[model samples]
Target: DTAVSQTPKYLVTQMGNDKSIKCEQNLGHDTMYWYKQDSKKFLKIMFSYNNKELIINETVPNRFSPKSPDKAHLNLHINSLELGDSAVYFCASSPGGAGYNEQFFGPGTRLTVL
Candidate 1:
């Protein structure tokens, strides 16, 4: 009964490979998001979806794509992964509203490139 969960706490792969990360939420939230934290620990928003519709897209590489199976799940797929892609990917969710709704983040999936 976790509010938010992500599979494979760590991922390691060679450059040019492709991989994916799964995310799910049980809190009945309407908005879901993906964030990447670099080695500097700067968390940056990548994409956001509300009610299965994309609402925010921060400047990100095209190799990264986010898919929402439903309001409760959002998956991230990365193609042609590069060394630069090696970072901690986090899934988050929040209630869709006008105010400053706090986002609940997953433990995070650390991706390592070789």
Candidate 2:
């Protein structure tokens, strides 16, 4: 079984549209994260959740939201998407807390905004 999985592996939309991507992990990990990979291939952490509680948020815009229904699932919602938001979004999970364990990432969801 996949340790981590994301729905709608690809997303294409206009600049003003709204979209959401869903992620789930079966690894029984306590910490999960949302990362964005930009065109220059720079990976940055957008949000982190531990056991359904928000932990780290890296100054992300209010238009972006991360929700964790439980430890196994974290979802990302983007409203009024912008061109700058076009990037590969990755869902990851780790056994312990942030920076303490190896993270297993899902095959990313590529978002393209026109």
Candidate 3:
């Protein structure tokens, strides 16, 4: 069984289109996160949810949104997708909020915008 899973492992679309990626975890974790890995291989956290409450990272743009209906799932929605938004998005989960546990990442969703 997969500990963490993301649907539609690859996404290809044109600029200005909107897209969404779904993620689910069966680890019984309390905290989940959305991270983006850029072309330069820089990984950055976009959003985090603890028990369904959201905490957005300060540097992330408003075009990115993360919603969690429950503790085991976190879904990412991107509006007005831009060229810069093309990257590998990863879903992760931890037992508790920041600094308490190691995050287990999903297979990742690669988004390509033309």
Per-model TM against the reference: 0.96, 0.98, 0.96
Q: What lDDT tens digits, residue by residue, belong to model 2 across residues 1-114?
A: 999999889999999999999999999999999999999999999999999999899999999999998899999999999999999999999999766699999999999999
Residue 35's lDDT within candidate 3 is 90
Alpha-carbon lDDT of model 3: 0.92
lDDT of 3 by residue, 42-111 (tens): 9988888889998656588889888898898899999999998999999999999778699999999999
Ranking by TM-score: 2, 1, 3
Local distance difference test, each candidate:
0.93, 0.96, 0.92
RMSD of 3: 0.9
Worst 10 residues of 1 by lDDT: 95-104
Cα displacement (angstroms), candidate 3, residue 98, comes to 2.5
